[model samples]
Target: MRRQAVSPSCQQLGRPRSGAASRRGVLSSAAAVLLLAAGQRPSFATLIPDAPVVGDCPECIGEVNETLNACPLDAPSCISTLSDDEEHFAAPWQFDGTREEAIEQLISIATGARFDMGLIDSFGGVRQTDAAAYIAKGVLAVVSGGDMPEQPKRQRKSSTEFVPFDGDVTERRTTPGGAEYVRIVLGTGGGGATQASNLSEVIDCEFLFLPDDNIVDVRASSRVQPEGKLGSGGQLALSITEGLVLDKNVAGRQVERLRKALRWDVAPVLTDFNPAFNAEAPVWFERLFDPFNRRNKFQPSGLAYPAEGEGEERPLRLPARE
Candidate 1:
């Protein structure tokens, strides 16, 4: 029989589904993380700690030196990627409070939404076609990766992903990191993409993740060498982009009331993760993220349950994770 390498048991990980899993006190400080390996997990945002590991490249450095990190800042919401379904919601949960309350609220409410990774690029098509097919069928993925942004014509932008919509979206915003822009990706057509290098050179970015937290943060910082020939294919450009772009949907019953009262029509999706991903680390990893979006691609069964009574107002329940 083959012998297995002796290693740290799951119990010795020192992080067995912390706070929210237990549904109790606020989760461990954002600085704390689930230890899968002994050290050096690259942070895609908040999924993995910003701690350094051995043989690491010098380009990607975390926001802070891992000190002076505090609450609210430490709040999980700050770290998570907000979901599109939480438009206009009165956030009943906070990152610093009881984890149970946050979990309870999430479980009680139906988070109506779907997470999908689409394919519209040939360069990455061969690699991601399988994953794309899965999402098309409404299957869920915990984490996904495939292809480079070869589809959607290249404008001037940096990217870690492509959007689901292939055409014009009524509303679009510049992705955080001061790099990504909003543009229509027409299915297989190359629409909006960043500058390119040799078609053969595909940079592979493996992101570390923080599960259970609605707000999973992943990001990277880069620095080009001081000297490299431009025409010779040598350029040192440093760019750090937080992974995951959150697009929200319209929700809530305050359309006319709020429009007239506030003199502004606020779409419900405004309640999602910040339009711009902060370069800083989050304090609470799970509180701000949608439970379903945390570890898998979940489609809520009922985005919004139809009204139960003829003339009664109650919380509009949405979908559940698939």
Candidate 2:
């Protein structure tokens, strides 16, 4: 695991930050799988015309299998982990929700049951929550006070946008295409890294309500190609996001079965001993990370991104609008 970051600066938003999007694995009869952004066993089988991709390897799977076999028995539940990105700090944190409410709220924060959200900080070291928190922490609480698109009429969206959190830096840019473009900051690295950058990079990304599957998948890969030819720069990198979906049915079934056995409100499976909240979900591994497949109605998270290189991330020169 990497060293924990100290007093990292929070990203300014119009969208979420791009940090460590990984997952862990657990062995299964057919294949290994991880939850969240990491993806299903074979999400993207990029052949590169004739070049080899991740699927071209065999030993990788074996190494992953051995790792899952060693997953710790102790794990935390959604409540504790939720405290970070979600914080149901509304006094009575945990809930004894009705079946319908449970399903609705489950859709809101459920991780593994559906291949929609990130891994269980357990799988490998994904730190899936960072992406959501990057936005939730910085935007959700403040968007209402901003001077831009009033939160979309739709409560559930895939991505949205905002101006730089910095006031003086709020000089907006109008796209050549006659559209509006917003600026924001993104976290360089965390889970414990240095502070966030004061100098914001201008990219065309959006704020979104990504499907939990967007962060985790068992039957697919979740990756977005940067809009340019080569890729992002070394100085200030840029990232494209891909998402996943959970078999809501499968997740519900498992929760149902566990509910019957444990007779608990929400299943205890979400609990973890050494609970990790960030990118520690061990995304690389396939099993511990891969979500048990079933089916669910995945909603689009209104996170936004630039339209191709229309507003790709570029290093700010005018001493960030601070």
Candidate 3:
């Protein structure tokens, strides 16, 4: 769950900050104030020198200090005063495979049957596969959750529905830095007439294949404003990273399905947890104040496949392979 910060000037260019971003800004100021009152050195103050300080603040500074010191810096929304770039989330990985193997892995995860089955039990199941068909044509459309009218009434719903969107995928090319990469431009709509006009949700995903480094950098950025929590784009990037290089001892039905799909000789090791996927507070905070840390956490909105005994499995309509 690594984030890239942009300059304040860049953040202010035409795009108004979201309420969540504003709230985070206020909380950052409060944290800075607590740091000043406690006579403790602020680590991130240099990044945000303009943060406000309160005069003669409460004695709760000690409590705040204790919590801040105990928590990990990368915890979701944990001490992140820096404004994230429109490219909200990055999930880079080093794997024991060749560039060709890495490309195959990406394709398998995006279009394979086993991977599709794995997603059925998970949150936000695939409602359609036409968008995925583009991957074979050198374009990948990473579908995220978006709202759509639930038919008959033609009223908009919340951002919890799985609506398919299509985006153009650029051909593989070499970067100026000598790294090979593919750029995927994704957005809601462009798939069908019924798809809502969610141009604001457009995002670009870049898959950078570093030369001789065995590293694949998966970066997702929104074209509109920077993302606060784990949106659909962030989740898709994280899921792709997990599929390619899962760490050892990370147990989940998804992981099991991935193993069966790829049929790797050795299971990949789990090195670090993606903050957007699984954020944890200190043990004390979890035991005493769990709900506070759980705020803004990412939860899967819908399932990928229908449940058992519901009905016969319906075939997904995908573009025929040439």
Candidate 4:
């Protein structure tokens, strides 16, 4: 005789109340699963399209795998061979210009010369400091009378003056490979100027160029003292380390990162080594060079009159103010 088959729920009827509840729970779970299968897809898969794979380029995958297998030991060799070359001061220039052009440009920077603004526009509205240097050199050539002018001097008070201490071409040489390098040290310090002066400024700077390496390094230090009326009466010091080079790809990446962090697309990075300032300028002080309000003043006696004149005009007094 065949025994009648009993439902699982029917078998649980003889168990405790929890057994009946457990049977209902199982039935509820099965129903829920069926409902889920019938409805829309889960949230994770919704955003991603129904592609077979994400970014599934075989070549890229192979490259990633190869890089990973190299481990930390061989990592240094993985970088491109032509990457940035940091060498001693005697290293040859790595730039893409002729030796004569490089020398002219280096000399221009040693003197306080300004370049054409068009050079900045060439690099897509960015601060191409390297290009600016070359352009400045060209301007210096045009303005110069075949020789650099005398270093500037400023009078601190009666019988006292501050002149550039080491205003000379420190290094001018050609490498064994025929590449030219120029370095100029321009600075003023150790002043015996008058102690009664209200304000005095001292500046020391160095400029170096490696044409073959396409690198420029600038090191500068400046100090401004205000004894009275200039401000609350303190010393304002500034130091800068600026190294620039011609680089587009890495510069573009730098610009992109800056754009994201700043939430605005600013100027492109035209030079690799950006200028660095150790301390921010106080808000009260204006920029050292104001392009808009540049003034040129000179004594007219040197322009026209003789070196010596009559007793009344000896001092060469200009017309009285209106």
Candidate 5:
């Protein structure tokens, strides 16, 4: 007698599910098996067109893999190296006043010099303890500056404006030797999205005030940007230090005493070092792909200073210099 072949759905029906559901599941499984046999697979590149593929640059992939294997699991968080745009100044800048008075004096002198140099548009002391509050205030200041109307030709110095002390402005600490240390962080950056001419920059300044020794030590450093050739971090640091020491009129008796006591020239010494030299890619990866992607570059959606006859309102033109 000839025996009838058992269908997959018929076999599954006796094992578990209802006849209709089992038939559907069996059909789906068969379709998947046929697809696999035909060498058809899902393409991730189709789903994410912009995603980088390792196979695209086999050499880079190999190098990356080698680097990963070479990097130790227990490596130091930060590797210390010399800075290229760091300036250090130490002198007998004795202050015959309390710590609070010294801090106030420093702030006043710094703020005045920055304003005179047109480095900052607006600045204030950081009172709130949290990092969030400090960052929020800085962000708000940038937003406000962006909304501000263009100043008169004579009043406006440069196109760029900065808001400083975007992080912890002042921090006080005591050493095991009972010596007091005060770290004053002075960060300055561009006026945000509105200011197209301005580029973001960060200046990390730490001031160590030692009352017993009657000397104040200062270290100012900034990252050297490839695009920012005109603004030297060394020059910026020197400018501020010079203003503090040489501004006899504003600094009053404290600076006067310090100057008189100092036998040698009080100048900041510049040191150059780059810790990220080998850690990062040789060239910025963004710039490599920038030609293919216009979005990588900044495009002003709205103009802070629109051109004359281009908008509904007449643009304010700067008067020609005599």
Candidate 6:
């Protein structure tokens, strides 16, 4: 994370300062002392604390230092290659909080958006996507949690790790550091995917929390091939890797509004290690019809579309990873 000092002027804006600034500052001195006594740190826009781990995560337990140290700086995209299928990529991000916080934030951000209909719209080509809308929505969801009775339920329950969308088989395993990991995979072209289908698309994603490392590993492969064509070599594969800081202190009615838009249920998905999944009917259904759950209008940027006659093109297959 980049480090910079906050200027006194910036900190004092809107609030009365206690130093030798003005009469208001002198009057606020006692209030400042009370705040300090209460253990409240003055807000510093540029200041962020060191990443802290809370629980034992398999991949992070023994490798905290190495993982945090290896996380790449924020960039338009990651330099590390994800696979060898002549198609790979990496996309990393920097955040303001811990790894667990980042994971929750990512879920909130990704699910809050309207599903990208490839060929017409995409979240990538970051050039066209609205970063503020994405980040703001996620922050609101986290801050509001289950407080808004009007908030919509964004997630559905799923007992089986692998749902029919990615594939029927979701796999769980231990990483090198013994961290619990969930993998969702889908493949349809040649000898790659398990479920046999003619569609030439593949999605492989791994979700894990590195509590020890204070990192969330969201790595995946997205590939596409020409339909009904044999080894056309027109496959497009991109690898994505992201590291984010999550802020747990978000609060405000804006978050409640966002929760309604995302359809997120405040109920915990995993209770004491048992997943509620969509096995039982949702506990709260009032938010679905809430007038406040307004959908955002989306306009797709054509960056994801291929040039005319690029190959025997197939419709894009978006991943539905939890």
Q: Which candidate number maximizes TM-score?
A: 3
lDDT of 1 by residue, 1-322 (tens): 2223357777776666665665543343233444324453322211111222322223222322211111112111111122222221222111323334433322222121122223333544343564556455443233344434323332321235522222212112222332211111111112322222221111111111122323212221111111223422233332122233231111111112111221222222333124233212121343245343321222121232223345333343433322
* Poorly placed runs, candidate 3 (over 4 Å): 1-89, 94-97, 104-115, 122-165, 188-196, 226-322
lDDT of 6 by residue, 28-47 (tens): 78777887799753432232
TM-score of 2: 0.13
List ranges where model 1 is wrong by over 4 Å: 1-206, 221-322
lDDT of each: 0.25, 0.23, 0.35, 0.29, 0.31, 0.32
Best lDDT among the predictions, by candidate number = 3
Residue 105 lDDT in model 1?
28
Summing lDDT over every window of 10 consecutive residues in candidate 5, give the lowest-scoring window: 75-84
TM-score of candidate 1 on Cα atoms, chains taken together: 0.15
TM-score, ranked from best to worst: 3, 5, 6, 4, 1, 2
Prediction RMSDs, each to the true structure: 26.8, 27.9, 22.6, 31.9, 25.9, 26.2
What TM-score against the true fold does each predicted structure earn? 0.15, 0.13, 0.31, 0.21, 0.26, 0.24
- Please provide, for model 5 over 89-120, each residue's C-alpha lDDT reduced to its tens digit, 9 standing for 90 to 100: 12223555565566555654443323332322
Worst 10 residues of 4 by lDDT: 59-68
lDDT of 3 at 312: 35
Preferred candidate (lDDT higher): 1 or 2:
1
> Please, what are the lDDT tens digits per residue for candidate 3 over residues 1-322?
2223355685576687799998998898899899889975455311111111212221101112111011122222111101121112222455566878866675445332233222432224433343344233332222333343222222232335433224445346665566776644444333322222232234334456667777664443333332333331123222321232222111112222333444333323322223333232122234344544432232221112222354333332332212
List residue ranges in candidate 5 displaced over 4 A. 1-92, 107-170, 189-201, 223-228, 231-322
Error of 3 at 225 (Å): 3.5
